[model samples]
Target: MIRGEWQNPALTRCDSKLAFRSLNQAAIQAERASSRTGELIIAYTCFDCGAFHIGHADLSQQLAHTVSVEPGCRECNLPIPEAKKRRARACSAKAIYCSDRCQKVAERKRRAQRQMASVTPQ
Candidate 1:
């Protein structure tokens, strides 16, 4: 990836991590784009809360969901967490989490109300 030195795919294959990263990003963009066309929609975290919401990634960030169970990317259709970066090897094939930031954002939002309530004067 640093330089065009890979003259052989077998002898000098590209890093799997980097390959997976680029592929994943492209997939996300494509998924978002498709959602805008009203043909595809990815259930992304509200960023305000961890609740499941369905809306076009490009058009608007509206809240919409039919099921309590969170779904993964439509393209891969794999069970994934809200956000994750590192992919575990021995955990399970159906791992999910696009990045750690997403996971944290979701977690924070999810616990925000609870934490606020605990600190509020009752």
Candidate 2:
């Protein structure tokens, strides 16, 4: 890409990895614009505008202000591993268990408990 190519406003340019100076500048700009105190973790350099854009590292696609959960496996009550946790968060439908074995065990327990209750007088 030539130097003049960078000048085009409508160019579909790729994101350039921001340098420390660029990130610092973006941080300062963000801080000045907002009264809230927060550090910028993600930075991207715009090739067309030659400007640095600052943002948070929320690759999970969750809402900006929402609290992210480190959810436990429902069936075993064990903490979900990092990769699985991310997958659960990313999934459109909620995840119920860490594995099929735990899910089957829980289902069997529920069925047995229901049978026992039904067999009793009360």
Candidate 3:
């Protein structure tokens, strides 16, 4: 049996829904439900109850709402490509620099500025 808590105890048993404490648990339950019912189930956070819930997965609608905007490199302002963005996302990075050379150049400039500021006469 799936483990979850009722959203409200006072309300009618049918009126309240079961809420999962964590996204991971909800996702596991959703997967089981999908296989048992032959439907695409999804796990999502409930805005009103602040808990996870299982619902129907709508891939087409989700794909339509996704934005394609990619940010430029922080140091040289060069545009980042889709491939690089995907790689950065997989590695859990922000992808600030377009390349390692640009990152090194930016670090060197920052180091020089710090040294110059420290050496300035009072």
Highest TM-score scorer: 3
Candidate 1 lDDT score relative to the true structure: 0.49
Ranking by lDDT: 3, 2, 1
* Residue 28 of model 1, lDDT score: 73
Give lDDT for model 3: 0.80
Please give the lDDT score at residue 54 for candidate 1.
Answer: 45
Which ranges of candidate 1 are over 4 A from the true structure? 1-70, 73-89, 92-96, 120-122
Local lDDT at 100 for model 2: 67
Any runs in candidate 3 off by more than 4 Å, and if so which? 1-68
Looking at model 1, residue 120 earns an lDDT score of 57
Query: 6-84, model 3: which lDDT tens digit per residue?
Result: 5564344324666898999999998899889987788888766677888877888457646886678888889876677
Q: How would you encode candidate 1's per-residue C-alpha lDDT over 1-122 as one tens digit per residue?
A: 49765464532322221221344454575477676685555544433332334434443433333346667743345566533323454455543545555556667877997898789575
Worst window of 10 by summed lDDT in candidate 2: 10-19
Measured by TM-score, how close is model 3 to the native structure? Answer: 0.38
- By TM-score, the better pick of 1 and 2 is 2
RMSD of each: 23.8, 11.1, 14.0
Alpha-carbon RMSD, candidate 2: 11.1
lDDT of 2 by residue, 12-117 (tens): 3424433335767876765554446453344556555666776554655325645777667887788656666567689765667777688789899999999998
Model 1, C-alpha of 88: deviation from truth (Å): 4.3
